[model samples]
Target: MDKLIKGALQFMQEGFNEHKNLFENLKEEQNPHTLFVGCADSRVLPNLITSTLPGELFVVRNIANIIPPYRIKDEYLASTAAIEYALYALKVQNVVICGHSNCGGCKDINQEKAKLLPNVSKWVSQLDEIKQQVDFTLELNHYEGQHGLRSWMIEKANIINSYNNLLTYPNVRQMVEEKKLSIKAWYFLIQTGEIFEYCEENGHFMPLGEKK
Candidate 1:
């Protein structure tokens, strides 16, 4: 607890001091152009990864970067509410769904750990649909050399699946149809610091630089 407080104080004293103007302006308004949906993994810092400064991104993070299909209910749904605010209030033009390699959530899905975390298990059940959509026969080992191919595939699939689910939101759907918004799926390999973009044509994720 002391360490946490110390960290907070450090941020207030040093970090915030360095960027006082940015924070002050952000206090008045934020006009981030992108909605970043990413995993709650400690290592996957969206701002750092993108080299984005303060107030550049509207972010929504979850255990596995999951975006549940839109639903109208009285329940408190953090991710959905964030998405709505980003799309409707912020009017973000791009929504990026980013998943990372060696994700605990993806590993859990592969290991069938859902039975232990009942709520998480239930929430991740949506990923099962994505799993079914993947072709198990793909020889990832032959191509990617097998260090973390399976996990990478799972990570990529989750990003694509979440992006598809994002479209289920009425506001998102309407905005996208009007060319007011675009969606991108990305996989970040933490170990190698490589980022891949989902190639819809090839039905696989390829390194971003390899495209075109």
Candidate 2:
């Protein structure tokens, strides 16, 4: 509690003052280039990772960075609503679906730990459907620690699944087809602090700076 309060105070004094002009221009409206859909992990700082300024990236973060398939129902949809706003309203050019190694959400799905929380259990169940679509090459028994390599596979596959789901939206599909929007997947390696972008052609993630 004290740390958060102090952090806010520090931001007010340093961060806000340092970028006063930038924040002033953003007082009325914002124009962001990318829609960064990322996991709600404390360690995953989107702005710091991308080195983007305040208004450069519009963000949608959830338990597992889950973007539910586009649907029009009466229920309140936080993540889904954000996606709609970012697309139709804000008109962001790029959409990045980022997943990371050692994701607790993915681990829970494989290990059945999420069942303890019924709501979380329901939310991550969507990933289970995505899990079924991928052909996982690693068998759990082959990994020394069941959580390491095996969980990594699930994490990477979940990103691809979410990327596919993004295409289900009619506008997103049309924009992508017309080359008006570019959607890409990214995998973050926490241990090494490296980011890998998913390549549709090569069918795997490559280091961000590596030439295709």
Candidate 3:
């Protein structure tokens, strides 16, 4: 905790001074352009990855970047509420669902280790549909790679599932159908610091800057 406090003090001394104008201007209002849904992993820095400033991204980080389907009578819906605020109030143009390599949450699902965590098990069970799809795909293709590849495949599938789940919202669906909103799936390779965007027409994730 002390270390975090010291880091905050240092930010006030150096980082805060450097972005003074950006911070001051944002005090009155903010109009972030993108809603970045990413993992709660300490290593995944969405702003640094995109080179975005304070007011550029409205981010929501959760386990495995999971966004459950929109539900009305749930106990709590942190991710769902954030999605609503970002799309309706903030009016973000793009919704980016980012899944990273070597995600512990993915590993939990792969190994069936969620039973130990009651709440987490319930939350991660949302990926069961993706898990079944990955299993079927691997069986059909006869996958013969390392376990790492299997994990990576699961991560990608989860991102795609999130993209689909976001569209299940009425407002989100309306916006996308009207060309006012776009949902993008992303795979982030932590080791290489590379990002790939999903191309629906190609049914694959390709490097962001590489032309199709």
Best by lDDT: 3
lDDT of 1 at 31: 96
Model 2 steric clash pairs? none
Candidate 1: tens digits of C-alpha lDDT, residues 80-120? 99998998889899998999888888664434565667887
Q: Could you give the C-alpha RMSD of every candidate to the true structure, in order shown?
A: 3.4, 2.6, 2.0
Q: Judged by lDDT against the true structure, how good is candidate 1?
A: 0.82
Sliding window of 10 residues with minimal summed lDDT for model 1 = 138-147
Per-model TM values vs. the true structure: 0.84, 0.90, 0.92
* lDDT for each residue of candidate 2 in 2-114, tens digit (9 for 90 to 100): 99999999999898999999999999999999999999998899999999999999999998888788898999999989999999889999999999888877755434555
* Candidate 2 residue 81 C-alpha distance from true site, Å: 0.6
lDDT of each: 0.82, 0.85, 0.87
Backbone clashes in model 1: 0
Clashes of 3: 0
Candidate 1 lDDT at 114 equals: 52
**Which regions of candidate 2 fall more than 4 Å away from where they truly are?**
109-115, 132-146
Estimate, for each residue in 1-212, the C-alpha lDDT of model 3 and write its tens digit.
99999999999999999999999999989899999999999989999999999999999999999988877874678888998899889999999999999998876543455556778777888877787777788778888554777788889988988888898886788888898997888899999999999988878999997726
